[model samples]
Target: MRHVVAAVAGLIFALGLGISGMTDPGKVIGFLDVGGAWEPALAFVMGGAVVVYALAYRLIVRRPRPVVEVKFSLPTAKKVTTSLVVGSALFGIGWGLGGYCPGPALTSVVSGSWEVGLFVVTMLAGMGLHQVWERLSARGSAAAAPAPAAPLAEGPLKGVDA
Candidate 1:
């Protein structure tokens, strides 16, 4: 079943994170430090991940569709806007300060670290705030916008009977 496969894959991923020392906040923080007592092991971990992802993406693209989906749902947005810049800046700031992104943060939660807990709480709050902002912006835009009239078509087929 899909659930079984997903669970097994998640367990494997968690094990990988554990074995790679990615679940340790100290290790991650050391890597980020870059000046004092810097650890370079995280670079190796990142390299391995990049290699795996490159190979996996190539293999997946060769397939007509994924095993569990009719088609791949890829992001269509390509614009570089204010939202993207601000979001990325916030994410970088959080990662730099906490030494843990979502994946590693969740994994390190098992260590009973208060920093990880606080990071997760703030992360959740940020997500909630973004949702609220999005809803309010949409409502404001809708209220300010005017309805469009039907277009008058031209050409040979325009006035032809259906």
Candidate 2:
């Protein structure tokens, strides 16, 4: 049942992207251009999404738990870290350069454009690289951490019966 709901939600989102012309690299690039023949239509789509999410977030938080989950799995991080900054920058750069962020790229795949296919493939490869990097970083941090000191030895006869 949860899976069905998720599929339906994804279908609706993809349809929205397609209907809003977000699946087109040219359209997305036009929006990003900003200086030359900027396309402002997507702004409305984005603004509508923000408004909908704001309302949904408020309503959803009032519920003790989600309909399909035991509890909400929202982000708990409050501090900005280097990894977050770098990841966000990379995502923005990729979106600006390819004019296709992950969602739109996946939706555009059905169009059978080689460029989109290439972008998806590259995106997947980048995800894999990120995983590897994170694992290696975790290992390095663990290795650098100091091991717990050995428990101090009790005085002689400490274990012997009095």
Compare the candidates by TM-score and give the number of the best one.
2
Error at 136, model 2, angstroms: 0.5
For model 1, residues 1-162, the per-residue Cα lDDT tens digits are 778888998788778788888877788889888889899998888899889989999989899997887887655445565766887798888777767777777766777878888888888898789767766765666567643221211122222321
Instruction: Give the RMSD in angstroms, all C-alphas superposed, for model 1.
Output: 9.9
Looking at model 1, residue 123 earns an lDDT score of 82
User: How much lDDT does candidate 1 score?
Assistant: 0.73
lDDT for model 2 comes to: 0.80
What TM-score goes with each of the models? 0.78, 0.86
RMSD of 2: 12.1
lDDT of 2 by residue, 1-162 (tens): 889998999999999999988998889999998989998888998999999999999998999999988987775545666756887899888898989988899998988999999999999999899767766755665577644221112222221221
Residue 9, model 2: Cα distance from true site in angstroms = 0.7
lDDT of 1 at 128: 88
Cα lDDT computed for each candidate against the true fold: 0.73, 0.80
Candidate 2 — number of clashing residue pairs? Answer: 0
